[model samples]
Target: MVTRARRNETDPDLGVLAGRLLFAVQNELFTSLAKEGFDDLHPRHGAVLAYLDEGGVRATELARLSGQHKQVVGTMIDELEALGYVERKPDPADRRAKLVCPTARGLAQARAADKIMSAIQERHARRIGRDTFTMFKAALIDVTDHQRRQQPQ
Candidate 1:
């Protein structure tokens, strides 16, 4: 159903809603992970871990994915290194650039987070009807895609 913005409303922007929803999801996942004795991991760390587990990536690429600076990403990588969660390897094409990959322990942690995310999404799906949840996801994806396409070069 189409709805109009309420008069005098202060927050009808989708960006605001997206940020709030992201925070809610992250907060839940963090709480769930913390209970399992993974309190040392952080939200940003989780993002980097997920990215690395998918495959090796340059530090700059990871920074772009995380919307953080390269220096900050490098710092986070160092922390992950200290925790034995990630390690740097030689990049095949660029010897000077390092490829980041998660350690076995990091992969395990990412997999655990995956399960937690699934459970959280399942709970969300149950709260909202299955069809409603599907439509909501599609709507969000459509908006995100459209915004990306509209960005000026």
Candidate 2:
């Protein structure tokens, strides 16, 4: 038999709950990043930084991957370039196209962010039990994919 939990008037909706989780995680991630000498970075910068690849990516592709507007991603690319985190170069495949490639400093920052994020996830998994946390992550991924599919193109 399926049973639903009783709802209270004060219960948070999905948007609120998701926002709370995102904000908390980003706060912790950025705090650790600042300590690692990426103090210039803001949460908005994650719209680019988090989706970067060592091989390089086009600004349009980055925008698509991060779910941000192309203009916004272009602005971010400019900021990151000024900060010495990334640079633009001609794409070998298409000389007219520019590829955003990470600088040495950017690679270091990416490594640090990966380590910090892993530590955060490990802590949470430990708190909730490994199996439960794994299940929770899988469920979250499924929910996210479903919602994305529902969105109009």
Candidate 3:
């Protein structure tokens, strides 16, 4: 059996490293959120919650921002609505369009998530030095942007 210690002998590929980082951070964030009375939320909900704003956002925009298909985003919206995290309302600019507006509970969750993420980043920055952490973030963003640009339109 290949022990985890033995696996560390070789450098991980970019995807593995990225997945590890993502899942680790998500685990910490969700666990903390659950402790704070948001036990109903899961990591998948981030596709919708991450882009929500007070002014309300269109479901199509959420799909675009989240890189999810419109149908998937629509389903997520339905789930969030059922959970009392959001509501569908008429768009002020377009009567034919519906806007997804965050509920008070959703806003509270967003606030908590922001605080938690900030603390997590701060902890990592302190460990690696703020300047290095900043550089790392910039490099990561560059890599991600390059990858996105490479995708077929």
Candidate 4:
């Protein structure tokens, strides 16, 4: 079972609820750039960037990771490539496959962004307390794990 989420709560002050949620998301994004240095990145780039950060992967694998069509990943890759965030190399494991890896700059940005995100998360943890934050993270992980496991393998 999942812990109670604010989504189910009917807020007496709609403006406050909306503002808080929006502020949190905006703050996190800005915080990411602030700690990482401003970069021309879009949120959609996040899914792909995270995958590349893990390790080099084939284009098709990225498509799977992003839960987007192969063509969509191709488009995203084009953008990342244009931005010098990633480079593609022919996959030696299989002919006719290309693997994407982050550039040095990309790696640096990823590390910085990771720090920023961690800081924002820490702030949230301070607000909710470690026990609540732990439960929240565990619940989120459980939800995602369950959903992913349900996907066709």
Candidate 5:
């Protein structure tokens, strides 16, 4: 069996760089939110919050959009409900189904997250030239769109 060659320290892979950046941004946003009186909110909760609709969305749809297992999203919704961020109600279209809705507090949290993300993007643009940052974002969007298109529905 042939051993894989070691990667150079100075040239990290794209996945490594992406993970590091994501972690840093999440940490900063969580800390900022905590200071704004949202101490109960955790970065992982973003998986659900990011895809939430203002009106409401079904639990199954949330799981699909967040790329999380139904059980995992269910647990998260329970926690969010307990925290007064979300509530489960009978779906208007189908009474048999439940919709996960954001409370006023949850809406505030989403707004805060958006603001925090914008600030973080601005910081990145400043550190890496604005053009470079724009290009990076475009490349990421292109890759994500391509991959999404390739995935089986």
Candidate 6:
């Protein structure tokens, strides 16, 4: 048996609730970054930043991982490069290809984002018991892993 919250009044679909929670978390992260003087950063930038590898990644690979168009990723990379967050260097393996790598400022921002995410997770654990939150996260991972395994490569 499920009980509805007074504010929500009714139960939301699981996917809808998940999406809302994700957006809320992202909004809070962006707000925190803005307060810390990263005012120019936007939620859309996460598409590129989140999937970036430590060494570097090719623009086309980044676009595929980010589920964004190649041109769009290229533009975002250009903006990030201008902002001193990332750099484009010629890929050693491919003379004509370029790899996007994070700069010192970008690494700092990544650290800050990690801290913010940890704080958010701690808050959620406190709100819904640590054990429950752990189980919930594990369940989500399992579901995603299962879906990934089922997909054709």
TM-score winner among the candidates? 3
TM for every model, in the order presented, reads 0.79, 0.90, 0.92, 0.74, 0.85, 0.79
Root-mean-square deviation (CA) per prediction: 4.4, 4.4, 2.5, 6.1, 2.8, 4.1
Query: How high a TM-score does candidate 1 get?
Result: 0.79
- Mind giving the per-residue lDDT tens digits that candidate 3 earns over 1-153? 877656654767677788889899999999999999999988888899999998899999999888888999999999999999999999999999999999999999999999999999999999999999999999999998888778787
Query: What is the lDDT for 4 in model 5?
Result: 28
Per-residue CA lDDT of model 5 for 1-153, tens digit only, reads 332234524566766777787799889999999999999988788888888878899989998887788899999999999999998889989999988989999999999889999999999999999999999999998976776678766
Pairs clashing within candidate 1? none
Give the local distance difference test score of model 5. 0.87
Q: State candidate 2's TM-score.
A: 0.90
Selected candidate, larger lDDT, 1 vs 2: 2
Worst 10 residues of 5 by lDDT: 1-10
The lDDT of each candidate is: 0.80, 0.90, 0.93, 0.76, 0.87, 0.85
Model 4 alpha-carbon miss at residue 54, Å = 6.6
Off by over 4 Å in 4: 1-27, 34-36, 149-153
Please identify which of the two predictions, 4 or 6, would achieve the higher TM-score against the true structure. 6
User: After superposing candidate 6, which stretches have Cα over 4 Å from the reference?
Assistant: 1-9, 145-153
For model 3, the superposed segments whose C-alpha errors exceed 4 Å read 1-9
Would you list the clashing residue pairs of candidate 4? Answer: none
The reply for model 1, stretches above 4 Å from the true place, is 1-12, 149-153
Per-residue lDDT, model 1, residue 71, is 93
The alpha-carbon lDDT assigned to residue 53 of candidate 6 equals 67
